[model samples]
Target: MYISKKEIEVRYAETDQMGIVYHANYLIWMELGRTALIQEMGFSYADMEKDGIISPVIDIAVSYKKSLHYGETAIVYTWVEAYNGFKTTYGYEIKTPDNETALTGTSSHICVKKENFKPIQFRKYYPEWHKAYEEAKK
Candidate 1:
């Protein structure tokens, strides 16, 4: 499996009065991780957009294992969990600099037409992109 990692600094604004990183911040971290993964896969999601393909998250699930505090560096680990004709799933892990896992999550997304916003199957539209995913699937 291919994995991508990115580091991010936890800002004070990310924490609540209790000094714990807000739950929502993990979602942002996941985005960062996903972006890195896409780049590592040799594909610019931005390019996909320019090509008239837009991928939008249909669902996400996150579980917190420990709390994070401001000023700490976070390592976001990401992977392309699964890819199908109609949907793709990305997995993520957010951890501290010391390798302590703080969160685990996954997000599901679908590619659609940019103009009409209609769903598009990978095999039917971008066969090469789908092939790369299939190669990685092995």
Candidate 2:
């Protein structure tokens, strides 16, 4: 499978009172990873948006395995977990500098018209993009 990697530097402001990275930060990291994955796959979310479509997350789930601290670099690995004509699920793994898994998750999204929020047939709307995802998910 085609997996994309992105490195994020944890900031002090991103930590909780306990000095550990806040849980919600994982969602942001997933988005960064997803953006990288899309770029790696030769697609751009911006282009899709400019074409009057926007992909919105429908579901998300994350599991915390280890605590991430400030001043540390986190590497996020992203890949296509599932894809169909209607929706796509992106998988993610955030690891610490020491190579320990800090979090794992998946976010599901569906493409819709930006104007009316109506769902689109992704395969028909972007055949090449859909085929690329299909090949990557293999």
Candidate 3:
């Protein structure tokens, strides 16, 4: 897999009263990981919007393993888990400095028209994006 690594520092605000990172914060980290992976492929969501394209998450899932507390550093491993004509799956692994997994997740998204926010086939309008998805499959 072509993994994009991003370091995340656990902050007090990101944690709940129990000191463990808030569950919802993981979703934000997932987005950060996805953005990093896409940028690594030489593209940006901004550029996509400029081209009148939009990609919104259609489905998402997350699994928490170890608890992460404030002051610890976590690494997010992100990649294109799978893709097809209209859907793309981005997978992520969030771990601690010692490489212990804190979370695992996947987000499924589809490219769509910004004006209508309607789903569109990536192969037709975003061949480069589709090409990246295809190459990543290997």
Candidate 4:
């Protein structure tokens, strides 16, 4: 599998009253990880939006194992977990500098026509991107 790693510095704004990172912030980190993976594959989500296609998450699952605090750095490791022409699942792992997993998750998304929100196959609009997912799945 091809994994893309993004290092994020935990900011104070991302934390809660107790100073630990909030749960929802991890979702945002996951988005960054996903975008990093797409960019690494040479595809731009902005261009896809300009093409009138939008990919939205249909489902997500996350597990938090350790608490991260502000001033700490977390590395997000992302990869293609599975892909069909219609839907793609991306897996992620957020780890500390020591490589200990702090969180693990997967997000599944489907391409849709922005105008109608009707589901579309990624292969039809972005064959190279689709093929990259296929290659990464192996």
State which candidate, 2 or 3, has the greater lDDT.
2
Which of candidates 2 and 4 is the stronger one according to TM-score?
4
- Give the CA lDDT, 0 to 100, for residue 106 in model 1: 92
Residue 76 in candidate 4, Cα distance off native in Å: 0.2
Residue-level lDDT of model 2, residues 1-138, one tens digit each, is 999999999999999988899999989999999999999999999999999999999999999999999999999999999997789999999999999999999999999999999999999999999999999983
Model 1 lDDT, residue 104, Cα? 92
Question: Residue 125: error of model 3 in Å?
Answer: 1.1
Clashing pairs in 2: none
In terms of TM-score, the best-performing candidate is 4
Off by over 4 Å in 4: none
List where candidate 1 sits over 4 angstroms from the true fold: none
How well does candidate 1 score on lDDT at residue 109?
93
State model 2's lDDT.
0.95
Candidate 1 lDDT score at position 49: 91
Q: Looking at candidate 2, what is the lDDT of residue 34?
A: 98
Pitting candidate 1 against candidate 4, the one with the higher TM-score is: 4
TM-score of each: 0.91, 0.97, 0.95, 0.97
C-alpha lDDT of residue 86 in model 2: 82
In model 3, which regions exceed 4 Å deviation? none
lDDT of 4 by residue, 38-126 (tens): 99999999999999999999999999999999999999999999999889999999998788899999999999999999998788778
